[model samples]
Target: HVVTARVVVIIVAAAMVVIATTPVRSMTVVILTVTPVTTLLRGECIELETLGESGGEAFCDRG
Candidate 1:
């Protein structure tokens, strides 16, 4: 009984380590893989005031 309990504890500890490390390793890979693709899909963004005209200079077509 004691030996079985020790084996179970060791198995649980190893599983815990695997589970903890899996997502961390996956996250680094996922971020590195997804970041550039997402950025490419997301292009430039012009604010509402900046799109047309503000106090500074005209951006839209004045003609």
Candidate 2:
């Protein structure tokens, strides 16, 4: 089966919309094995960093 790039993009956009609207704390199912949109505020960049072996941070603090 050949999956076109356009289709994939549309799917991703739809998923992002869903994530953006839903509240983070109430979400049960993980979106693509990662946390849904919460750390990133409107007009912010999403950044992910590893603090320690088991510690990590996801935020939208650009600077």
Candidate 3:
């Protein structure tokens, strides 16, 4: 029982490490609906977005 539990724990830890270090490609749309006359943080933004597995090129519409 102890041996099986250890093996399972090792496998789970390995998977966690791999997932944490891996940069998985995914798709998501970022929409910025900010009024021309609004809050102080209305225009500028430091966005960190990701792309899909198909390739590069971020799908964003900053308007």
lDDT values for all models:
0.45, 0.39, 0.33
Once fitted onto the true fold, the runs of candidate 3 whose alpha carbons sit more than 4 angstroms away are 25-63
- Count of backbone collisions within predicted model 2: 0
Candidate 1: C-alpha RMSD to true structure equals: 20.7
- Which residue pairs come into collision in candidate 2? none
Q: Give the TM-score (vs. native) of candidate 2.
A: 0.34
- What lDDT score is found at residue 38 in candidate 3? 20
lDDT string, candidate 1, 1-63, tens digits: 345446546655655666577976755655554465334323211332355435212322221
Worst 10 residues of 1 by lDDT: 54-63
lDDT of 3 at 12: 53
Ten contiguous residues minimizing lDDT sum, candidate 2? 39-48
lDDT of 3: 0.33
**At residue 48, what lDDT does model 1 achieve?**
25
RMSD of each: 20.7, 11.7, 18.8
Question: Per-residue lDDT tens digits of candidate 3, residues 1-63?
Answer: 345446546655655565566536211111111222122122212121232322112213322
